[model samples]
Target: MGFHTFDIDRADALEDESRYRHLSAEELLAVLRPHPEMTVADLGSGTGFYTDDVAPHVGHLYAVDVQEAMHDIYREKGFPETVETVVADVASLPFDDGALDAAFSTMTYHEFAGEASLAELSRVLRPGGRFVVVDWTATGAGTAGPPTDERYSVGEAASALENAGFSVDRAESRTETFLCVASV
Candidate 1:
């Protein structure tokens, strides 16, 4: 794999509520501020775990995952009508320029963090569009998520977003994770 991808065999684990201990639905919505009129995309939407949380709040959601099998798992679980399955990489999305009103990723940033992917996100989001990222931090103790060596720090993510033409509004580190809010 080019990056650390989630295994579809463990798709059931993603639906567990305990997974929210790192980043809750409340916190994600608070930062994403998804509205009934907003069109959003959930990048690296594994099994639509978090996608199911945000779909109801947004007018539309594109559940993007590199693995089609993940989407199949989500389909079996049933998702909101607002949710649309999209199989694509973050580096290359099938959307027009400024197509999304807002976008977010949960525990998936490390899998897609790069200049090309970040720049693609910047290209797809409208001006002033918000992009919230919650992922395992490199500074973590390895209790949850990927190994420290495989993760990126908040500073690194912030810098990459900035290099991709995003203005980071908020960047903070939690015990084992980081939250970064960047605007296009």
Candidate 2:
């Protein structure tokens, strides 16, 4: 199981630009490599922060979150034409099998890391589709994001994806975060 869910009251913090210092939009876009015709999902999307960054690049973007209140907050922020809000958990998405061309999660992996969640990700993504994850690392200093004990190291995440039948192409650990790119 993962850590506790984020507090809905702190949803505003998710929109802070300073968060880019940990995971920038440019860096996420570079790894995501979204094409105009591809369909993508922003898993655990809160307030559509990073989701907005990827929306313009994809044909369809699903801002998926377990909390409908978060979706309400995103709606107030103005959703893009291509972005659709889906109230669903990562372990049990409403998408069809192989419906998505790709999927990405920003700083929410620790909250949803488990066998069921990873398997569902593999099921929804098309063959050769990418799954990008950027989250606080267990090896990091306890200064930002979740506590170290509640996080996963890059190696643990990579191994979990591999065990879920994904081919990990990139796994890098930075000062406070880890980025992992895998393909179904």
Which candidate number has the best lDDT? 2
TM-score between model 2 and native: 0.98
After superposition, candidate 1 runs with Cα above 4 Å error: none
For model 2, how does the per-residue alpha-carbon lDDT over 74-123 read when each residue is reduced to its tens digit?
99989999999999989999999999999999999999999999999999
Please give, for residues 28-98, the per-residue lDDT of candidate 1 as tens digits: 99999999999999999989889988999989999999999999988888999999999999999999999
- State in Å the error of residue 20, model 2: 0.8
Clashes of 2: 0
Total clashing pairs in model 1: 0
State the C-alpha lDDT per candidate.
0.93, 0.94
